[model samples]
Target: MTDAIKAIILGIIEGLTEFLPVSSTGHLVLAGDLLKFEGDTAVTFKIVIQLGAVLAVLLLYWKKYLHIGVNMLKMDFAKSKGLNAIHMFLAMIPALIVYLFFKDMIKTHLFGPEPVLIGLVAGAILMIFAARSRGTKTADTVDHLNYKQAFGIGLFQCLALWPGFSRSGSTISGGLLLGTSQKAAADFTFLISVPVMFGASLLDLYDSWDLLNSDALTLMLIGFVTSFVVALIEVVTFIKLIKRLRLEWFALYRFVIAALFYVIVIL
Candidate 1:
């Protein structure tokens, strides 16, 4: 496939899976395999393009992050908003440490063709359990949650390092278990993703700075634009669906998709 085609496909995959409890990286890897684009360069391209999806999260929640610093400069650190920002960073520290130490291992070992299958099945099973165990409780508001709960959710967020496990899924499940309402869990999941994804993107660039020339820069832009449009749409739709439906249905999707991949691709 041409770089343009790769850009479009990867962007759509990222947008669709970024919010759901399915790993977008897994889907992108499968897409790459199917499209016959399974080389080191292609793999790097997909990872780099994910910068676009993270950008969507940042764009959608720019005010929260912006105010995190603005409140500090104003010496209004006593504000709850500023405190939330502090909690957010504190929560991020665990993943940052893990990422810093094992970044290469995750990229080199975890996110490969073999592990994609493993992630698909394992994550699907976990989602099934999450759906069943989830109480009638709805975590619809982040304000109701405490700092320790957010940090707990962030710790669960670390499971995404395992390739197929959805970061959103893990965090939401953690939030739910920690007594966050469903919506609160989901909202906090999205909010927490901003730092995690951006940090990963920057970290990737930092590690691969040598390979990111003008060509790579241009391709990353294409991916960012594509993922932005798709993710915005995804965010709007996902919010609506979760508000009115059960996550068990998405688990069903994870099962069927994973089953199909097992039979047709992995096997």
Candidate 2:
């Protein structure tokens, strides 16, 4: 297949799975292996294209972000009620620290089909356990989450440093186990993900600047735009339906996808 075709396919997979409890990185790694699109350039392209999904989140939550920003500037904590900068910071620090410390080790050792398969199954098991054991949710909305809960979610997010452990899977399950409602957990997960993913993409792009010639830039742009459009639609629909959706359903999907990839590609 052509590079453009591969970009489009990967972009679609990233968009469709980025926000769901499914592992977008795992899918990309497996897809790249299948498409013979492995190597430094390919890895860089995958990470950079995630900016597309980040853009989608910004577009969807611009108002909330604006309110936080304005309130922060004015030093008006009371007015900046709900998911604020502090909450995001608390929810991001743990993963950021872990990623910074072990990123090189992780990239060298775990960015592969075998590690992704293990991560998928392990993440699935965590999701299943969270779904079964989560009881008496105390936070019904993002605004209701306490600092302790946000930090707890951040700790859970550290699991996503493992390639196939979905960030959303880890965070949302963490939120659930910590007493947040489904919609609340989903909202917090998506909100915190914007800065984290955007920063990671930019860092990866900076590191791979020399690799991004005209041809590679063209392919990355194609994937980027495709992922943005698809992710916007997915996020909007997901927000509407998240309250009704169950984590167990996504866990089942992770299990099925893991088995299929292991049988069809890894075997």
Candidate 3:
């Protein structure tokens, strides 16, 4: 396949899986391996394309973000109810701290098929448990989330540092277990992901700036644009369907994917 074709394929995978309770990194790793796209540059490409998904979020939530920006400008934090900047910061802190400390070690040791398989299985179990044990929902909407719940969800997001453990999977499960409604949890997950994914993508792109020549930039841009369009569609569809979908359903899908990947790629 040509580089552009490979880029488009990977971009679709990233877009389709990025917001789901399925691991986009895990899918990219396996797809890249199969396509012979493995390298430092490929890794950077995967991270940077996540900005496409971030842009999709920005597009979808422009009104919310604009409201928050206006509130901040007016110094009227209290007026901007329902998932303001403070909640976003609280939801990001734990994962940010953990990533800063252990990112290199994680990239060195866990960025592999075996580790991703393990994370896939483990995250599935966690999702199953969260789905079954979620009881007596307290926070029915993002507006109802407190600082403690936000921080606790951030702690769960740290699980996603291990590749196949999906960020949406971990955070949504965390939110459910913490008594948030399903829609509320999923909404918050998408909301906080904007800042988290954007910052990470920018940082990775900065570190890999020298690797991007004209050809690489073209491929990356193709992947970026593809990811943006597909993710915009996926996220909008996901939000509509999230209320009816169970975490257990995603867990089952994860188990099937992990088994197939192990047999096809690892075994």
Q: How many clashes does each candidate structure show, in the order listed?
A: 8, 0, 0
lDDT of 3 at 38: 79
Model 2, range 1-267, lDDT digits (tens) per residue?
A: 999999999999888889888889889998998999888889888887888999999999999889778877887765666777788888889987887778778777888899999999999999888888748988999999988999999999999988899999999899989999878888899899888888777777887798889999999999999999999999987866655678788888888989999998877
RMSD to the true structure for each prediction, in A, is 2.4, 1.3, 1.4
Judged by whole-model lDDT over C-alpha atoms, candidate 3 comes out at 0.87
Q: Kindly list the per-residue Cα lDDT of model 1 for residues 1-267, writing each as its tens digit.
A: 687778787888888888887788888887777877665556567777666777777778788778766765676755554236656775677777788899888878876667877876777776666666746553357766667877888787787777777877777767777777767878777877777888887888777877777877777778778987898888877875654455667667777777787777777
TM-score on alpha carbons, each prediction: 0.89, 0.96, 0.96
Predicted structure 2: clash tally: 0
Between candidates 1 and 2, name the one with more favorable lDDT: 2
Q: What ranges in model 2 sit over 4 Å off?
A: none
Tens digit of lDDT per residue, candidate 3, span 18-38? 999989998988888889997
Worst 10 residues of 1 by lDDT: 77-86
Q: Sort the predicted structures by lDDT, highest score first.
A: 2, 3, 1
Clash count, candidate 3: 0
Candidate 3 wrongly placed segments (more than 4 Å): none
